[model samples]
Target: MKGKLRPVGSPVPFPRISERQELPWAALYHTEFMGSGTEALSLAVAIAIRRHSQVSTPEVIIPAYGCPDLVSAIIAQGAKPVLVDLLPNGPHMNDVGVRGATTPSTVAVVGVGFLGIPERLEELSGICREHNLLLIEDSAQCFPPASASKPHADLVVLSFGRGKPINLMGGGALLVRTDLAGQAEEAVAQYPVSVLKVGMKWLIKRLLFNLLMRRLPYYVLERMPLLGIGETSFHRLDTISRLDLPESVLQAGLRDFQRRPLIHQRYDTELAGLEAWGWKCLASDRSEMSRNDPQQPVPLLRYPVLAPSKDMRDRALAVLNSEGIGASAFYGRTLPQIEGVEAAVGGRDYPVASDFASRLLTLPTHEGVTSADVTLIGRILFSVAES
Candidate 1:
C-alpha cells in the first residue's frame, strides 16, 4: 500500500513551539486548552448551564448524524442529549428538526461542522438566542483562515485529534464568548494539567499512525480492537476526564495550522476535478456557506460522496481498497444507533441521519494524495456507480 492515497487527514509533525503566545485564533476569544475535543465540549456544556432544582434533567440538542463523543460529552456533564436529524442528502442539521426538539429542559444546542463543512451557524445561532439556549460550535473538522473573524456561536470548540484539520494527535481548545469568559475560566481552573507521560504516548502514537495508516499494515492492525486504529465504539461518561494540552502538542498544532492556505488550495483544485466528473459530494462546498469568502479557500479533511445505497458504498470501498486507493465508509451507523447511546436519545428514529450514514463514502484529500490520484479515484467510483 506504499502508493495508496490515504483516506481522511494528513500526518501530524512533532512539536517545536517557536512562539506559543502567537498561535492562530489565540486573541479572538478567551481560550482554554484541553487534552481532547470531548473534554473541551464537556467543559463548555458544564459552564453554559445553570443548575436548577426545577429542571432535574437538563438537555442539549445535537445532530443525529454526529460523532459519538458529542453524546458522551453531554452525558458526562449530567445532561441528556436531544438528537435532531440532518437535512435530506446534506450534512447540516435540519432547522425545523432542531426547533421542534427544543423544549423547556433544553439549555443548549451544539452545531457540528462535519468533515470541514460549516453548518448553518448564523441561522442556528438565531434560533438558540430566541429560545434562550446557549449555542456551541463544534468546529473540530472545519478550520477557517487564521486571520478570519470568529464564528457566531457562544462557545467554539476545536480538535487537534488524529484525523481532524490540525492533526496534533491529541489536543483541543475551547473559546468562550466575552460574556461567558469569566465563568468559563473559573470552571476550568479546577482541572489538572496533562502529565508528561501522556504527551509522550501521544507523540509515539502519532508517528505510528502516520507510518501505517492507509497501508496494508493498517488494514490488518485495524481489525484488532485493542490497537484502536479506526475502531468506533462508545466511551463511558466517566472516561471524559479533563487534562491540560501539552506544550509540545500545542506547538505542533500551531505549525500545522500555519500551513492551512496551501492545503486548502490543493483541496479546491482536486475537488473541482472530481466535481467536473459529475460526482455529488455529501456536504455542501465551503463556498456555498455565507461566511466563507470565495477568494479564500478552506481545506476539507476528506472529499465525501454519496453512493446510491449501502451495498454500492461497500462495493466501492472494496474495489478502491484492492487498488491501493484509500476510500472509506464514514460513520457506519447514526448517533442514536451506537451501542449504549440509545437510552440517552430515547430511541428516536432519524430517517435522514440513517439514510445519510448508509450512503456516505469519503476519499483522501491529504497532501499525500495527488491530482492524478483523484482521476483514478473518479474512474473507480464511476465504475462502481454504473455497476
Candidate 2:
C-alpha cells in the first residue's frame, strides 16, 4: 500500500462502497436534533423531571456500556450521574446492581439500545415507570428495526453520525414519547440552527468520500500547486464536517443504502477464519427497516459480541492495526465507572455494561477491508492466538 499524507484531524473516505445493503433507521432522523445527540438527550431528560425537587442535585441512572457523551451531557445540564453496569453485549441491565445503588434522588434510568442485541427497552421502561422514575433510551446504539420495542421511555435520543445505523454526516434526534415531548421541543427549538455549518458538513462528506474512493482529482490527493491544502488546513464550520444536520435533509437523503457496497461480502470472506470472532447476527434474515428483504443490502455497521478475554482482545487489535485494518476497543471504559457517577448512582454495579466495555472491539469490516484483507487480518490474529 502506498503512503498518503493526511493531516492529523482530516478524515479519509471509505476505500470502497458496495451498493446492496439495508439502511438502518436512525440515519433518517439525524438532522432534526437541536444540538449534538448528547445535547438533545440532555434536554429531553431534563424536561422529564419535575420543577420541585428537595435534593440539592438531580440524578439519572446510566448503564456503564455507553459513550462518554452521557456523562458530558449530565455535567452540562447540572445534573448528577448514576452509573450502573449492563449485561454483556445484550441490552440487559443489571437491575439488581442498579437498585442496590439507587437512591431516593434517582430520577431516571437511561437505556441505550444495542446493535443485533434486543434492547431491554420494555423491561427497563416497566421498571422505571413502576418506580416512578423516568427512562431515556439512547437509540444511538440500537438503530431502528433493531429497536427491541416501542419503549415506553420518557425520552429517546437518536444519532445519525459516522457508521451509525443511519449514515448522515452529522446529526441526532431528540424524541420525547411521554408527556414531556412538547416541553423538550420548546427548549430545543429555542436553540437557533446553523445553515453555514450544515452546508460545510455536506461538502466535507462529499469531498472526503470522493477522494478516498479515488474519485477526486489527483491534484487534491497530492496537495500540489492547485490543491496543496492538507487535511489539517481547516477546522471551521465553513471548511469541514461540523456534523450539523437539519431534519428535512435527513428525511430526504440520509442513510441511502442504495449507495455502493450494499453487501460488504468481501469483508466477511476475509474475517471468517477467527477462532471466535463473536459476530452479532440478526435474529432473522428479514430486513428490520424495509419490512422485507431488499435485493441488495449493507449489513450492520458493527458486529458486536463478547470475546474470551482482554488479552485476546488486545492481541487481536494489535494484529489488525498492524495490518492497516482499523480496529476498536469500543467504549473501553464504561461511563458508570467514574467516581462522580458512582456517587450519583447511590452505589449500583453495572456488571453487564462493564463486561461489554472490557471485551467489545469493532473491526474494520465495512471500509473496503476486503475478503483478502480479512484473510490477512485473520492469519495475523490466528498466529497471535496460537503463540
Candidate 3:
C-alpha cells in the first residue's frame, strides 16, 4: 500500500482561458484581481461592512460546513461570523437557518457552491433583499465559474489557487455588482500593487508541481509530513494586494476550466449506480435555479457525495485513500470543530452541519483524473460499501 502509485490529492494542471470569458462579467460588474481568493473575499467583506457602517459590530452569515477561510475573511474585516447550519444532508445552508441567523448586525450572507455545485443563490438573493443584506457568491470551488450575465448575488469571489477549478498557482478575483461598484473600487484603490512575477522561475515551479503530481512521485510526496501535501489551515488575510494578470497563466487556467466538465462527467457516469448502495451524488440534487445552467455541466473542484452513514464514510475513505485514489473527507469537521474557529464564531451545536461533515466525501475531479482512474474509484467505493 505504501509504495503503490497514487495521484496527488490536488494538482496544479496547466490550461488556457480566453479573454472572451471576461466579456460578460466586465459588462455586468466591476472586476478586480487580487493575490488570492481569500484576499478577494476579504475585500468583499470589507465592502459589505462599509455598506452597513451604521451597524456596530457587524455580522456575516456563513454555512457551518465550509473552509476556515470563510471565518478568516469575516474576521479580517473586524466583523463577526454567524454560523448557520447546512441543509439536512446537503452542502448549502438551510434557507430557514440563514433567515433565523440574521439580525440587526447581519450585513451579508456568503452563499458557497460547495464542490462545484452552485448554491441556491436566487433564493438567497431574495432573502438578502428582504433583510436588506448583501449576498456574496463564493465561487471558489465551481466553474464555468460564476458570471454576472445572470447576476444572482451582489458580489462574486473566485479563486485560482491549487485544486480550484482554474488553478493559476495563486490569484483570485472579485466581481462587484453595479450598485456596490463604488465601495469595491474605493477599497481596491488603497491596496498596494503586488510585485509577484510569473517568469521562468514560476514556470519551473509549476512544471515541477505537475511533475510531482504524477502517481509515482505523489505516492512518495504524500508520506512526507513536512510538505503538508493536502492540509487545510486558517491563514489570516493581512492585506489585500492588487495583482497584474499574467496572460499566459490566465489563458491556461481558462482552458483548464473548460476541460473540467469532461472529467466531472466521467465521475458522474462511472458512479451512476452507487446510489443503490447508499451513496448520494450531490450533482443529481442541484437546484434548477442555481447558477450552473442545466444545459452546461460546470466543473466542480471535486465531486462530493454522502455515504450512507458515518461508519461507512470512514471505511470508504480509509479504503479509497489507501488505494491512492485521492478520495477525501473534506474538512472532516464543521466550522466550530476546527482548531481556532469556535473562538471566532463562538461554540454552538450545529447538529445538521456535524452530520453532513461526518458523512461527506469528495473525490478528485481535476484534469489529471483519467477514465480508468474513475472506474477504479467507483469499483473501490462500491466494494467498500458492500463490505
Candidate 4:
C-alpha cells in the first residue's frame, strides 16, 4: 500500500538575492565555472595530460564504484580510464587497488569523496607524487569547511547539480592548484559556451525537477520510467559538452555554499537520531576531520546506509516509497556493472565494488526534511530492518 511520501533529497530553496555571500575557497584557488561536474572533470583531464611526453596511451585511474560520468569525462578527453576497487566499507578507493591499477600510461588519479565524506586524499596524494601522477579530488558531494586545510590533490572539482552539496540546479567549478592554473586555463579556452538550445534545455530541466521533486508529484512520476525521473544510464562521451551557467544559478550556488554550516547541523541531528534508533550509516565518523576532533560535524549530501542484503534493501525501499519517505538504492550497480558501459570501457574484476553497490541505500538530509520527519524515518528503518 502507498504511504506518505518523504523524498530522500530536496531541492535547494530558491535563493534570496539579499543573502548572496562570498565563499572563502573561491579566494584560495583558481576557479572556473562550468555547466556540470562532468565538464569540470573532462577539462581537468585535458589539462593534466596536455603536455605529457608519454608515448603510451594516456589513462586516468578512477574509483570502480563511481558515476559513469567520471569514465565518460576521461574518454571524452581521448584518454582511457583504469578502474580501481573500493575499500570494503566503500565509497573510498582501496589504496592497494589504486597502487596495483597504476600503469606507466597513468597520467592522473581521481580521488572521489563519495556522499560528502572526503577520501584519504593525503595518502592518495603521496602515492600520486611517488608515481609522478596528478591527483584530482572529486568533491562533487563535499563542501570543505572554511576553517579546514586545503585538500592535498592537485585539482578539485565541485558540482552544483540538482542534489549536490551546493545545488543551484546546474553548474560546476574546477579549483586548480596554482601550479596548473596556466595549463587548465588553456584547456578550458578550447570549449565554447553551450548554444542557446542547450541552455534552454537546462532551464527547462531545472524547472521540471523543482516541480516534480516534491512528495506527491515525485511518488507518481517516479514510477513512470518514460519520464526518467531518477533513472541512471550510461551516456556517450561525445554528448558531453560545456554549457554556460545561468547567472541566477551562480548566485544561488554562492549563497548555498555559505549556508553549509546550518545544513550540516540539520544533518548531524538527523544522523544522530537515526543512530540512536540502531540504524548503521555507510559513512564512518572516523574520517580525517572526525579523528582530529570527534565533536566536529561532517556535512553530508545524503545519509547512506547499507542494508543486510540486496533483498532487504529492496524491501526497505518499497516500504519507504509506500510511506512517502524518500529513500533510494543509489547507483544500483558499480561502474563496470552499469549497463552499456562495460562494452565501452572494457571489463575489470571488482567483487567488492559490486557487493557494496547492491547494499547501499540513502536517506534525505536536505533542509526540507524536519526533525519529526527524521523520527518517522528512523522508526520506518527500524521496522524494516527487523522485518
Candidate 5:
C-alpha cells in the first residue's frame, strides 16, 4: 500500500466493444436519462410542484443529512425543502419526523437510498398515500435497484456520476410512473437531447481519468489542495436535458451491477467483528421495499460503519488514509451546515443527523478494492478501538 492511493470509489470501467442489450429498466418504467442526478431530481420535483399546483407555497420533505444536491433540486423548482431528522444512527428518515414535518403545503417526500441501502419505501408509500403526497425514490447510491411489474415510487432518480453505483462518467435517469407520464414526458420533451460525442477528445479524457485513478497518480493528486479531492460543495442546477445513451454505457453499467455483490460480500465477511471493537456496521437487517423480492440483499456504493465516538472516528480515518485505503466520512456535515445551503434549510438543530454525521465513516467497496484492502481496513479499525 506504499505508492498507491485508492479513491473512495472507482468509475465503472469502459466496456469492451460488444453487442448491446437494451437498458433493462426501460422495460419496467417510463425512463428518461438526463445530464445529472441533480437535473433528474429537479425535473421530478418540478412535476410534483405542477401536479400539486393547488398548494400556494409547495414544500418537499427530505432527510436532514444528505447531499446538498437534494436542496438544489427542490430549490430549482422554487419549492421549499423541509428538513427532517433521520432515524437514530440510521441512513433513512425518522418516521415520526417525516410525519411531523408534513403540512398542507407539502407536495412530496424524497426518500434517499444512502450508500446503496434502500429506504423503507413500502412504509413511506403508505404514509404518502394517506396524505396524497408524491413519493420520490432517490437511488443515486443504490445498486441492484428496486423495480417491479408496476412502479415502486411515483418517481425514481438514478445517477451515473464518477462515484455512483453505475459510473458512466456523468449521467442520470428519471423513471416516471404511468400515472404521471403525461407531465413528466411533456417536461422532458422541452430539453434538447445530449448525445455523448465519442471522439479523440472524449477518448483522451477517458484515458487520462483512468490513469489518474491509479494509486501513485491519485496519491499525488490527493495532496493538491486546489483539487479539493473529497470536499462537498453545492452548485445550483440550472438546466435539464435528456441524454442520448450509447450501447457501451449501458453495457458498462450492466457489468458493474453484476460484479459488485462479490465485493460487498468480501467487505461484510472481513468486517464481521466490528462490534467487538465498539464500532458498528450500518448494514443491519433494516426492512425496505425489496424485502419480499428473491434478490434480498443488494450492494452498497460504500460499506459504512459508525465509530464508538467522533474522536475515534477521526483517528481511525487518519489511520485508514495513511495506509492508502480509501476511507471517508461521507458528507461530514448536515445540509444546513454546508455553506450555500444554510439559507434554504435554516439553522434548525437536527440532533440525530448531527450525531450520525460525527460518528460515520465509509470504506471503499467498489470493484477496485482488493481483499487485502478489506483486511487492512478491519485491522486498522481494531487497532484504533483498542488504543
Candidate 6:
C-alpha cells in the first residue's frame, strides 16, 4: 500500500481580501501588512502619536486576549498598551474597552474583530474624540465598509489574510483620514514592499483553498494531521522582514473586489441553529446599551463557551482540528501570560482577563462547516460538557 501523502497546504500569493479584488485604498497606500493586521494597525498608531506635540508616550487599549503582536506594536512606537477585557460572551471591545480607553495617556484605541466578530466601530470613534486619541480600527479579521461601526478615527487597517472572511493570503490596506492622506502616503512610501514568499504563499492559498480546495478529497486531505510543516505564517512588523510587494498584487485585489465584492450579513442561515446551542454570545454590555443605543445586531464571531476545566480547550481544539475543521483556543490565554504582553502589563492578570482567557474555547463556523461537521463538533463539545 502507498504511504499517505503529506498534507500539502495552500501556497503563497497575496491572499484574497474582503472583496475578491484589491482595496481601492491599497493603490493609495501600498504596503503589505507583514504576517498580521495587528502590525499594520499598530504602525498606524505610531504614526498618529508622531503628530502629537507632546513628548508623553501614548496609551492604547488592546482587548485582553488578543494579538500579542498588537501590544508589541504599541511599545515599539513608544506607547503603552492598557489591556481591556473582552465582552463577557464574545470577542468584542465592550464597556471594559471604554474603561480602558479613559486614561489620559490613551493616544489611540485598537479595534479587533475577534474571530470575524465585528466590534462596534462607531463606539470607538466616540472614544477617540472624548480622549483626543486616534482610533485605529483593526478590521484584520472582519470584512468591512466599516458601515454600522463608524469611528472616523485618524486611521484604520484591514487585512487580506487567510481565514479572514475574505481570503487574501498576504496583503492589507491602511486607511487614513483625508487630511492625513498625503502624509500617510509619504510615510508608507518609506516602508518596504512585500516579500516574494509572502505573496507566493497567499496566491497559492487562493488558488488552492478558495478556488480548488473543495474539489480535493473532503476527508483524507483535509484531515491529514501531522503531515505538518512548521512555519510562521504571520509576519511581525517588529522585525525588518517587511517585504516590498509587486504593484500587480494590489492591482489584482482592486480589480477582483470590483468584480465579486465581499458583503457582510448576519450569521449564515445554516449556522443560525448555533445561537441557541448554549453558545453564550457577548451582546453589548449594559453601559453600551445605555450609551448611543447602538441598535444594530452585533456580528457573532466564534461560538465561544466556557470550558469545564483548564484542559478542555486544548482537548477540544485537538479534536476539532483532527476532524479537519479549524478550531482554536484562539486567544490561547490572557495577554498577561504572553512573553511580549507580560513585559507590557508588568505581569498582572486581572480577574476578567484571566477568567475569560481560561474559560474560553472558540469553534469555527461558516457555511463551511458541514451539517455533519457541526453535528460532530457539537456532539464532542456536548460530550465534553457532560463528561
TM-score quality measure for candidate 5: 0.94
Instruction: Please give, for residues 90-116, the per-residue lDDT of candidate 3 as tens digits.
Output: 887899989898999999999997877
Query: For every model shown, what is its TM-score relative to the native structure?
Result: 0.87, 0.69, 0.92, 0.86, 0.94, 0.69
If the candidates were sorted by their lDDT against the true structure, best first, what order would they fall in?
Answer: 5, 3, 1, 4, 6, 2
Top of the candidates by TM-score: 5
- Which residue segments of model 4 deviate by more than 4 Å? 1-9, 12-20, 145-148, 194-208, 239-248, 257-279, 284-298
Error of 3 at 69 (Å): 0.6
Top-scoring candidate (lDDT): 5
lDDT of 5 by residue, 265-286 (tens): 7866877877887788887554
- Candidate 2: where is the Cα deviation over 4 Å? 1-32, 51-56, 88-91, 115-118, 145-149, 178-180, 183-186, 196-205, 209-248, 252-255, 258-298, 336-355
Query: Can you tell me which runs of candidate 3 are displaced by over 4 Å?
Result: 1-24, 287-294
Candidate 4 yields a Cα-based lDDT of 0.72
Candidate 2, residue 28: lDDT? 28
Answer with 1 or 5, whichever has the higher lDDT.
Answer: 5
The weakest ten consecutive residues by lDDT in model 3 span 1-10
User: Per-residue alpha-carbon lDDT of model 4 for 1-387, expressed as tens digits?
Assistant: 243344444465454446454454555577777768888888888887875646358989998888888988888888888888888866889999889988888899998887777888888988998998989888887766321355488888888777787766666777777767876776778877773233556567767877776666767877777877666788865643466554555666556554544344544454564545344576656363431344565557777887767887888888876677777787888887888779756787688888888888887777666677667766777777666
lDDT per model vs. reference: 0.73, 0.53, 0.79, 0.72, 0.81, 0.54
Candidate 1: minimum summed lDDT over ten consecutive residues — where?
283-292
Give the worst 10-residue stretch by lDDT in candidate 4. 286-295
Task: After the best TM-score superposition of candidate 3, give how far the Cα of residue 89 lies from its true spot, in angstroms.
Answer: 1.6
Candidate 2 C-alpha lDDT tens digits along 139-227: 77444433323436666777655556555545666765534545455555545665524456666776765455331332245446555
